[model samples]
Target: MFDDLISLCLTGSPPALPQDWWLRWSLAPATLLPLLGLLAWLLARRRRPLPLVGWALLALALASPLCRLAATLAAAHMVQLMLLLAGMGLLVLASPPRAHMPRPGPAAAVHGALLWLWHWPPLYAAVLGHAGLHVLALALLLGSAWWFWRAVLLAPPPWRGTALLALLATMAHTGLLGALLTFAGEPLYAAPGARAWGLEPLHDQQLAGLLMWVLGALGYLLAAVALALRWFAPGHPVRRATPAH
Candidate 1:
């Protein structure tokens, strides 16, 4: 029985089209079992609906046809990465973990570094070709991003300003990376079957860059603006303490 399941988990070659992309979902036990366990844990703890929603996003990124699509198209891979990062942000915001990091700056830096490192052309190509490296890249990317979001979201009131700066910094770095990819004269990363999907390799990379630049910056910018609003609201504790003159 376990052998049968393991056989289904093999990392197959990239799918060629006119293959039905929607039907190319991954059935890897290694991915599915852990996600199921996490879902059970979330239910047992009775976490809020938001966290459950976040978990569903993570599951969709890993188990749906998007996973197989990522193997063939750079744009699809960027979408998968964005889904994972967005899900991690949602998870941390809804149910923040115990804050061990006293400041958001370092966490943000680490997270940004990991994001840039994985997207470096050589490393990106190598990781895409090897299953183990791909898994490791995902783990590092998600874990660091979660830590960064948690630190920013749960910072003490005194640190809120710094947290806002951290968010902006993240937005800047990711946007810069995206712009580089978008404006490059040639494709820096390889996509095995991009042409089959009507995208040349350079076009695929540019689309991915646009997704990261616009969508990634938007997520962090929205969070920063929300935090700023909360800090400045008239009913905030700091503002409410002003003496009645």
Candidate 2:
């Protein structure tokens, strides 16, 4: 059992992990840590609301390195995405005694530029290929949004709010940003020097950009509705002053 846990957490091997395998293996522990906490909370108190920090932690998982592998392998991406949603979904469902505890909710005032940063604009420089980072960022953004949608429904207040907002923003940002591609006179990502994804270089990147914007629009519409549900719910922490009749 110990060996299996190690394998699952470190390299999916019987302990002979390759250098790249270590990354996925490393992620499993961080993802499982919350489950450990949830287990402890459940054992201590059979029934009680989960803390808000737990929800925050969950959002972090969906958006960051936790799903890094998912962005690399199409098949692995689907599997990891499901695992992410399931893990976080179950944790939120129980709402263990230690959860639903809030920690530094959304800022009182929002900045347009910071909001832009949250979109995490393409570095446009670090990319080994002009379009590599852009393509990669889209994969991360869209994949996380899809997986987190299920988790959002199962998440606690304010968390659901933040997740929903992030989802909405990602969609919008991708849309506006993707415009650069759709309108560029020539293909930027599949040029002679650009990296190729088994296609004519830049072909995949151009298509990817179109899909990113189109999908982003769809996510925005769906997430907006989800946010509305939270807005209407009584006592939702993210809700602002109720509009007067």
The C-alpha stretches of model 2 lying farther than 4 A from their native spots are 1-31, 34-171, 181-197, 229-245
lDDT (Cα atoms) of all candidates against the true structure: 0.77, 0.41
**50: Cα error in model 2, Å:** 14
Summarize candidate 1's per-residue lDDT along 1-245 as a digit string, tens digits.
11212222223464535467677665667777988988887787786787788888898888777777776777888898888888887777565444244478888999999999999988887776676777788789988988888878777666678889999999999999999999999998877778888889999999999999999899889989988898778877642221111
Error of 1 at 238 (Å): 8.4
Instruction: List model 2 lDDT by residue over 1-245, tens digit each.
Output: 11212223222233221234324433345446755675677566554344334444444444343333323322222233334433443444454223433221222112223323322324322232233453454345434433444334434454555656655665566577556555556544312222312444345445545654575466556656856676567876642322122
Decoy 2 TM-score against native:
0.37
The candidate scoring highest on TM-score is 1
Error of 1 at 80 (Å): 0.7
Weakest lDDT window of 10 consecutive positions for candidate 2: 103-112
